[model samples]
Target: MAARLTRWAIFSVAVSLIPLIFSFIYLTTVGPTPAFFDLISDGELLLISVALTGAAIGEVIDKKTARIKSRLASGGGCFLVASLSSSYFVVVSAQDDVRKEIVMGMSCALLLLGVISAGLAMAASEGEEGG
Candidate 1:
């Protein structure tokens, strides 16, 4: 169960990071994606992913190095930076469309996933607690 939860947390993190590159490609080539989608692909989602990763690492600190937590957090932050980069063109290209809202919505969804994943990871890390 712990391993399963850890996998799930990592999966969520991966899913959140995907928007950074995928959304950019979709928006650039497909001509104006939704804001909700854009948001899902941004730093906010990545931040949440990072926070969750930190928590997961914290849970496992007894078996691993403490530095891994900070490192993974930085990795999430890097994803955030990548996601934010898409904003440069997205803002100027789609002004009056529903792009912003959709992107923001997506970002929130990714964030939600990240938070939930973090909780699960933290919970799973408790060696004595066998869920």
Candidate 2:
């Protein structure tokens, strides 16, 4: 179950990055429109992903640092950074209502997957130690 969850989480993270990458590409090509700055100046779209990344690092990592735990935590951290940075363009380019909601939805979905991944990784690490 843990392995399954990890795979799902990884897949979810990968899926989540797709829109962000496209957003970056779109912004590079078209430049930021006026509507972009009007909606997301404070970066509210990324709040949950950032918070989840922090919780994963602060709550999961410990003195022992089991291999699975460390890897997943680090991977999540990396994804968090990539997601946030990429999302900047996403929010900037999302001039339309549909695009805005899609980006926000993906961000929240990534956050959910990150939390589940952290929990499952910890569980798997404990299983590793015991059996």
Candidate 3:
């Protein structure tokens, strides 16, 4: 399980970096534009959310000590918190006023999903310890 988790983490990190690399290349080739930058930012945020969720899932599957599990849960919680803030900022910074409400609504839904994933990870960890 631990090995599988490690592999997953590595894969996720690699996948997350692809957009960043592309964004850098795009910025260097074609002058920066607000819309383009915003699109890249949104893509990055979505990738980050996926990576964090992957980490949480990995931690839950890993057969680690209770202390490690607790730490992993806390770390996942922190990531979710950061993601929530970033999502809110994305919605605020969006240029389309009409879509702002929709973006905010989606952000709230993602936040709820993050919270649920974290809760599940923690619960799974606890269950492993027969607690």
Best by TM-score: 2
Per-residue C-alpha lDDT of model 3 across residues 30-100, encoded as one tens digit per residue: 87543434444343444455555656656655646556756576556646655665666565566555354
> Which numbered prediction scores highest in lDDT against the true structure?
3
Q: Score candidate 2 by lDDT.
A: 0.52
Q: How well is each residue in 5-111 modelled by candidate 2, as lDDT tens digits?
A: 56645664455456556666677678754354333333443553554455445434542445764657565664565466456546645654445556655655555
Task: List lDDT for all candidates, in order.
Answer: 0.52, 0.52, 0.55
Badly placed stretches (over 4 Å) of model 2 are: 1-45, 68-98, 124-131
User: By TM-score, how accurate is candidate 1?
Assistant: 0.36
Error of 2 at 119 (Å): 2.4
Residue-level lDDT of model 1, residues 1-131, one tens digit each, is 66766676567556656756676677778776555544453335545545555555445554333345554554454345334433533553456554555556655655565466555445434444442
* C-alpha TM-score for every candidate: 0.36, 0.39, 0.38
> Can you give the lDDT of residue 129 in candidate 2?
47
User: What would the C-alpha RMSD of candidate 1 be, to one decimal place?
Assistant: 10.7
